[model samples]
Structure formats: C-alpha cells, structure tokens
Target: MTDTCVVVPTIREWECVRDYVANAREYGHLDRLFFVLVTEDFCDTDGMREMLEEEGVEGRVFDGEAREQWYEARGIEEYGDLIPAASHAETSFGLLYLWAHERFDFGVFIDDDTLPHDTDYFGQHYRNLEHTGETLAVESDERWVNVLYRNVEEHGLYPRGYPYSAMDEEVGETTEQVDHVVASQGLWTNVPDLDAVRILMDGDLQGQAQTRTTREDYGEDFVAATGNYLTVCSMNLAFRREVVPAFYQLPMDDNPWDVGRFDDIWSGVFLKRAADLMGHHVYNGTPLCEHNKAPRSTFGDLNNEVPALELNEHVWHIADDAGEDAESYAEAFGAMADALVADDTDYINDEFLTFVGEHMNRWLNCLDAIETGEPLAEPTPADD
Candidate 1:
C-alpha cells in the first residue's frame, strides 16, 4: 500500500475541517492516509489539535509559530522563511517537511472548501501515479492545453492562469503514449477554479449556483506533450514524492505589490516544464471533488490578480525555454529561477524577480538539507 499524506491549508472554522476529515475517511484510504492541516497565524493550533484528537483523526495542525518551531528545532530557521504566513502555499511546507522526514509515497492537496464525492479520491490518484500503460496525450497548436476544455459544463471557461492568448485555440488532437506519471490533477464540481476576472465576468460569484460541474464522461486522463503546458490548480492535486522538490507552490500574499493567487499556477508551470525535461508525465481527470467554495470578494480577488495577468502570458514560456536543456527537476527549476532573474521584460519587476529567484534556490537548498538529514548552515552576512 502506498503511504499518502493529505495537506490542506485553511482559515475556516473547525466544522469545515471536520467535514473534510469525515469525507476523506469515508472515500479515501483511511489506514494509509495521514492529514496535515495548515492554518493562518491567528488560528488556534492547540484547539485544532484537540478537535482532531477528539475526532480520532491521525494528523497534525500547523500554524505559523508551529512551523517556525519545527524549523528552529532543526536549526534551519531559514527554510521557514520560504512559506509565508496567511497564504495557501503553507501546504508546500507541510508536504516538503513530511517528505524529508516522515517519508510518504505521495502528497494530495485539496482546498478546505472541497469535499470528496462517492469516488475513491485517494485511490484514483494512487492508481494514476502507478499507471504505466498508454495514456492520452494532447497536441495543441497553441502549445497549451486548457485541462478544463470539454471537462466542465461551462463552454467558455478556462482554468485560472490559462493564458488569454491561447483561449481560442482548439484543443487540437489526442493520441496515445506511454510515460511515467509523476503528478495527477483531479477535477472539481460545484465551482471550478477560475481567476477573479473570469469570476467577475461570468461566474456565480456568490456560490449560490452550481455552474462549473465536471462532465460525467470526460474521457480518460490526459497529458500535454513536452512543448505544451497545462493549467494545474493545486486545490485537487496529487503528486509523487519525487516531484516535491520541484513543486514549491510559490509563496504569495506577503509580497509588496499585493499580487497574489498565481502561486499554484506558476508552481504547476515549473513542475510541468521540469517533468517534461525529466521524462515524467502529469495526468489530469479522475478522483473528482465537490468544491463548495467559500464566499469571498470577487473584486478583491481581481485586485490581487491584476498585476500577474500580463506576467502570466510570458512567464511559463520563459520557464519552458529556460528548462529545455535541464535533465533533472532541481536543475530545471534552478534554470527557470535564473531566467526569471535575468529577464529584461518590461512588465517584470526586478526586485520581485530577485526575491523569487533567491527563494527558489533557497527552496532547493532546504530540500538538500532534508535529504541529507542535516540542518542547513546559517548564511554568512556576505551570502545574505
């Protein structure tokens, strides 16, 4: 049996967390499944742990302080800096820490607002990761595959972070190929993951309507070819342990520009580029979940996303081009980071790029420390 850990980052009430735990227990592999709940700094860690204990669920709840303590005890305080407080990306820390210490075979990430359907959510992801037969491969003229295409009831909707330039490109054609699967992306019913702009324009902003449900017969899991990319929403995602080092989930919400919410999309782009170069595959469609999306200000979301809209168009392309010669996930990611820092694009912010690049390298270093079971050395003043 494959050991798996489910990581959820939430700021919701205990009732929401309890419901997700119950659903996972009902539909997922209970014995092999461990849960990791990451909450904001303001959330009560002790209360959360007590609730989980009362529910008899095997898991740990981490807030900012707990995360810091974990790193401090290991003498790797610098690593904790990679994950910001009050961000969905906190699960990245949970996943990486577990992989480095507890040693799970796979990590599954879901939003707190989501619940499992009658399907075997965890089992399907495990099977997809273990699949070795010929799987569907998509070839697109636009070098991108909107994974949401034909999979959702909505006709014109695309997944968040999908480039607007490629919105009109037909899905092209599908063929069959054999490859090793590294990541599996599941679909969601009720509410599909979309950018704020889309939600403002066409979505049921109040969550009062069920519009973006997944189509029943959406066909088998599919992957884009080496030169193409897919929009990977982290909310219903699972991936092999080997992919963790490449999937940092890019930290957000604490930056100066107020730009946020592209963390998963950008992380997915990096992972896909690295997976392509490393000769691994990422599959989409299976183990669907119901996203009972929590209500939020759509306009606020738009404000957070505005700055990255233009950057999204060209950033993944930069990753693809930068990672072409890489042979490993780490190398591919590092190459992309270097490219981001070196980019002279007008819309790209130099300071932000520098921060991102530095953190990318720092993330790799943290992985290295975990692999070696040694605390990362404190940086010298000059190094800082």
Candidate 2:
C-alpha cells in the first residue's frame, strides 16, 4: 500500500500506546494509513486486540530482541569494516524494515513517549509522504527548541555539536533555515532514501540523553548549519515503508554492537548522518509539538549580563531525588521494571540462562574491546 504507516514502538508504556495510535487515527488519512503498535505481548493484551480493531489500528508484536539482534548481526556483516562495533537499538531502528519493506509504502516511526502535537500537522505528514516520498523530520518553529541545538559542532556528552564557546548565557543565532530537525518528535519518510538513512544511523548522535541537551547549557548561537554531523535529530523522523525491509534485520539487545550507545542516541546518529549528505528538506506541517513539559527551569546564567534564554515549551529535564521531581525515576522505578519482567516466572530457566550467557558475553566483549578498540572497558552496561 502506497499509504502511511504509523508505527509506535513501545515497551511497558501500554497506557500511552492506544493514545498514540489514536493520534494517527485523527489524520484524515485514516483509511490510507495504518496505525500499529510494534510491541512485546503484555499480560494485559486481552483488550488490545478488540481495542485496536475497534480503533482501526493494526497491532503487531515485533520480535523486539530478534529484530534488534538480527539487524546487528547483518550490520556486522554489511558495515563490519566500518561499524567495527554493532549499533544499538536507536541506530538499529533504521534497520527494522530489513525483512519487510515490500508490505507498506510511507511510514512514520514514533516512540511511546511522543504524540502528534495536533491533528492538522499529523495529517500534513501523510500528505507529504504521498507527495514527496522523502524523509520528513519535524523541528519546532519556536526559538527555545531551535536554540537547544546551539553550536552545531563542539558537542560534549551533550549538544555534541559545534564549539562550546558558541554557547553563552543568551540564545545563540538563527539561520531561518529549517531542514529536517532530529528532536523528541521525529518525522521521516524513508522511501527511496533508505540507503542514506542506513549511513546516517552509522553516524554519532543521541536522544535518550536528550536531557543532556539542556545539561550542556547549549543555545542556538553555538549552532552552525554546517554538514551531516550537524543534522539535528530524528525525534520525529519519518520514512516511506519500502525502506524497512532493508534495515530491520538487526538483532536487538541491551547493546548491539556491544558498544555502549544509548538506544535513542544510536537512532539519532543514523538520521543525522543521512541528512548531512541529502540536501536540506523542510517538513510541510507546523510543529507536531506545542509545549514540551519542562520538569525544571534552566540555568539561564543571565545575570552574567547575557540574556537568559527562555526555554519555554520545549522538553526540559532536571536532576532530582526520588519523588521530589518526577515519577519516572530510573533508579527508584527500576524496581517496577524488575516487577514487570519478574511476573514472567514461567521463563525462570530461560531468563536465568540468558542472564548468565549475557554476562559471559560481556566479559568476552570487554577482552575484545581491550585487544581491538582503543578505549577498553570504559562504557559500562546500563544495569551496572
């Protein structure tokens, strides 16, 4: 079908999955588009089937681990000479279509955390896919969101863009130039542009560490529209369906390449790299996001005589103790993750074996990293 496919890849975010599918339903292209939840089968799966059928969505369980791992192994072969290390899930999402591109046409891969800001723009994305068939990435027109990419280069663990000097207490600069931006709500149309995307994911960038964008104290002034490395992010990268079968074959894991890139950052690198080469393209719709909740205020450092860049509306994150600031505390909430996965007592044997094997594999990888790659044993595992 030369129609649009809204694929929301979710994990434990059941409460939000239906709403995301519903957002795609809002688009007039409901018939022309398919909204699916590519997720693991949860215990509460009983109502999903009827709910999806009732809502006009196609719910499918992706072999999350298989999809991620298969692609990694293939990537190990395809780009082995270059990738040396396997790309994580983020870098791996671009490969999801590795074995299934023939089934659909245009596609938008959104995460469970994001939803279309409004229906008008959501519909516009479908139209863009129908028209250009090019990757459609979203970038908010607001200055705060735009300024977050301050300094296109000198990025550290965060903002990994331009020179750090570019950032001050004030908003950096504005070019009026808006290509596909890679942020929290990516918009892509990967049809004929599949190969380019594969190369992009191979580049370096991130999203899970997005809170770091705020941490870096980056503003627009530091951002310089230069080359591929400067390509924003895929918070909202959409592609044509034909592109999937080519890249979706990778194996999923805590760390695919065995290298330590966060899942979101790995995906961001892929889109950023591709756009670096593909000439700039603007999305047709307005911002899919209006006001991104800022959990805490930013350190405007304005008193230094520099203006305090108002980071209104854009997503902001802050460091806080348990319950003092947020509900999604990784440390505090980690127990829930354990609880969620723990309920599966039936797989005790399999789970235990997998755990032992995984640890052994990590120790071996560590040996390999030291013997081969320069930085040996630096990147620690997530749970570690």
Candidate 3:
C-alpha cells in the first residue's frame, strides 16, 4: 500500500502536536503518518519524541544533525549549519532529509495545530494525486487540488501564501490554466485561511468571528486558478515525489526577507512558475481541514508578512519574465532565481543565488550518496 510522509515543524506546541496526530489516528489516517517533529536547537528532541510515543504517533524527529552531516559530506560544512533555529523554514531541510533517505510516493505537510475533521483526510489528498491529470471530456483536465479548511469561528481562511488579489478571481475567468499541475494545496477553517497581513488587518485574536471569505468552498471539487497571484501554504499542502525537489529549495539564511515567513511563499511561486512551464497547473480548494489558530499578536504577524505583500508579486513577475521559452522546470526555476538576485539591489550582496546553487547541488549529491550508500563527489562551488 502507498503511504504519505506527513511532515510537521514545531518549537513548543506539544498539545497541538498531539491533537494533530490524534485527529489523523481518529480518522484512520495514522497508518502511514510519518509524523516528523522538526524541532529547533533549543527544543527538547527527546521530550518531543517521548510525547509522540505517548500519543501513539509514529515518525521521526530531526534536529539538524542529519542535515549537517549531509552538507558536510558535500564539503560545505560551514553551509551545513546555515539552517537557523530562529526560523521554522529549516523544516524544509528536515523534509528534504526524508526525501533523500526514505521511500514514499507522496509527502504531506500539516501544521501542528491543524486537525482532520473528516475521517478521509488522507484519502482525499491521495485521490487528488491519483486523478491529477484526469480529463472527463476533451475540454476538461484535473491537475492540482487544494483541500479546504475552516478555523475555530467557522470563517473560511485562505492559505498563508494565497494571493489576496486572486482570492476573488475564479479558476478560469481571468487567469489561465495549464495542462498539468505539480502540487496541490488544502485550505483551513475556523480561522479559515488568511495571510499574516489579513490576520493583522482583521485583528481577530480570538478567531471567534466568521468573516465572509471569497472562493472559500468548491464542494467536492478539485479546482485550479489561472492567475499569477494564487499560492498555497505549507500548512496543508502536498506534492508528488518528483515535484518535491523543485519546492524543496528553502531560503536558509537569505535576507532582507524573514527566514521563517516567505520561504514557502516564494518557493510556491517558483514551483507555480515551473509547473506552468512544464505544462502543469498548481491548484487549491477541498478535502477540508481545521486550522484552530493559536493566539498571537497581529503586530508579530505583520512584522513577518509585510514583505511578501510586495515581494510575492515581484517574485511572480520575475518568474514569468524568466520563464519565457524555458525548456524545463529546472531551467525556468534557475533563470528565475538568477533574475531575482539581479533585479534587487538588496539581494545582490546576499549571495542568494550562490546559496541556492550550492543547496541544489548538495541535494543532488545527498540523493546519490543515499542510493549508493557511499559519500558522493564534492559539489562544485557556484560562481560568485
């Protein structure tokens, strides 16, 4: 039987973590739930593992050792420690570790606080992948699918990376659809999904009120949007094994941007652009889950999200321009990364491209090393 490797990143949200696993178990989705507790330097890995065992959740805990060793094997020991404990984006590295070492057809990501309200949560995501390219007639094609989620107040929420501009836009009304899709996103409920900006603007600390949301529900349907603005959060997102490497490139320490915040958003944009070039679609909307947001300050969220409100649009524009005539997703993605570094003065000195280049090379080396059970050749340093 095929199974999904469920990835979760956390610092100290233990109870929520327990509930997350319990919900899946209750729904009978725990059989293959590889509940990874991606903790930081300060978090107690032993305690975290104990908690999971107590809750009967099966999985692994990553605390940078494997990542460090992998990078060291590639002769970039200094870069191995680049993943920051201050930000949660290091979780991407943890997931990449699993992808390199384990065998799984799909990888599923869910926040520690999110829970499955229905018994078929995993099945829903599985079916989406199974039918990714199914076309009912000559005019129809299914690519990416998003599972919807509601928050504590019964208000529909958009994923963190979801574009506010595209929130009101229908799938094919103003946007264009691609022939295939590389990834799918699931939405949240109660807190329904909202970016840090929206959460800040609304000032709903309690998440107690149900605000009317756009494109909130598409009953039992897998939908895709044609606009450049649509994006997905890692909270309830899944990708095919082949697509993981494309989105796996996380911003370890690239700055002027928050390490924790925009990693997934920018990666989603990169993946979307690549998917589009590959004749694939990126979609969002059903297999609903619940996002009972924990209480936090709007100011804190604003601090983290304000940059993306401007940069995400800029990122997509760069990807689109760079993607013209691109032969493959890798080519398109590389060109986009280069352009991102070129256009922005702040990014020029950031060594963003160099890090990305090294990261990708290291990933390739790591994958090869894992398969052969031997250390791979050293990675060639990218041009400075």
- Candidate number of the best TM-score: 1
In model 3, which regions exceed 4 Å deviation?
1-3, 15-31, 54-58, 64-78, 132-181, 205-220, 226-229, 252-260, 325-328, 344-384
Task: Kindly indicate the candidate among 1 and 2 with the higher lDDT.
Answer: 1
What TM-score, computed on C-alpha atoms, does each candidate reach?
0.91, 0.44, 0.75
lDDT by residue (98-117, candidate 3, tens digit) is 56544576788777777766
Q: Which 10 residues in a row give candidate 2 its minimum summed lDDT?
A: 311-320
lDDT (0-100) at residue 143 of candidate 2? Answer: 18
User: Relative to the true structure, how large is the alpha-carbon lDDT of every model?
Assistant: 0.77, 0.32, 0.57
User: Candidate 2 or 3, higher TM-score?
Assistant: 3
Question: How far is 101's C-alpha from truth in model 2 (Å)?
Answer: 3.4
- Separately for all candidates shown, the number of backbone clashes (residues 3 or more apart, or on different chains) is 0, 79, 29
- Cα lDDT tens digits, model 1, 169-207, are 766656656468999999877777888877767745652
**Residue 113 error, candidate 2, Å:** 2.4
Query: Model 3 scores what on Cα lDDT?
Result: 0.57
Q: Which number leads on lDDT?
A: 1
* Best of the two (1, 3) by lDDT: 1
Best-to-worst lDDT order = 1, 3, 2
- The best-first sequence of candidates by TM-score reads 1, 3, 2
